[model samples]
Target: MTVAVFDHEGPWTEEEYLALGETSQRVELFDGSLHVTPAPTPRHQRISRKLGNILETAAESVGLELLEAVNVRLRPGRVPVPDLVVTAPVDLDDPYIEAADVRLVCEIISPGNAATDNVLKMHYYAAAGIEWYLLVEQTTGTLRLYQKRGRHYVEHQAVKRGGVLNLSAPVRATIHPEDLVP
Candidate 1:
């Protein structure tokens, strides 16, 4: 009942989530709840940087942009700072990226966040109709690429260490799984 006071359908409103602003920790809003994740390990960051470089380079030719840990508003009350996002050209002045403009969202799964990346986020991104979803599992050095299929995601490809991930949508890129490690 009190949720109506926020004037939003969800328990948390976009304004309330925005009020959180930037924080030291990784805070994602989902269904009126907050999921706070501790900072990623240095190793995690390194992988994200390397993977981002590959995607960014390829995305440029297609007029797409790769952003690291940028706020992506999946819906009115849902915002997740993905590890990397491939989006169509957006206004630099905007504080957040809209789901409609996003082509792909990448997440580097670390020790504490496997479930969130593998299940929760996949659901969110797929439901948002993001064209692609890339998941890099830190421990296994594996990469899984998913494509949206009718409001859900289906595995498009999977590669392990010493293997390559090639995708044409979002951007044409070849990624070597080994490069994602320290």
Candidate 2:
């Protein structure tokens, strides 16, 4: 079941909302509207899995931890679940993810949401002070990286499938396109 509350405006407190479990359900709260994305297609799942695996291996070697499809509460009223998130080492008692602690957030473009992923989500992450945002598209197997530049994001890199994903301010890891495509 999907729950949406629009009457009580303003962002919800992090502790009150982030208590949800990390299940298969993709949950997001956008612009006062709560949206639950449908279960990803098999193709989407394949890419998510492969990307997660590659990131996991890279993160493990570096003392960083990677999270998959987890609710990253940017603010009270804005929470987006990225395809993958790279974060600093979690404190023992803090299980929730906040924007300030995130090193990088990545979203894989799904049909009908490419514009939102590349534009709206880009604005949101940048405004929230997220240092790096990665947008990966399945259509062309392209990965776009954006670095925050004073309340906006400037195009950092756009790499095709065979190209490597280079990121600074988080961890240095190169992502091969074959690792993401099935």
lDDT tens readout by residue for model 1, 103-129: 989999988889999999999998888
Please count the clashing residue pairs in each candidate, in the order shown. 0, 3
Winning candidate number (lDDT): 1
Question: lDDT for every model?
Answer: 0.87, 0.77
Q: Residue 181: error of model 1 in Å?
A: 1.5
Q: Which pairs of residues collide in model 2? A: 11-76, 11-77, 12-76
Q: Which TM-score value belongs to model 2? A: 0.82
- Candidate 1's C-alpha runs over 4 A off are 1-11
The TM-score values for the models, in the order shown, are: 0.91, 0.82
Candidate 2: global Cα-lDDT? Answer: 0.77
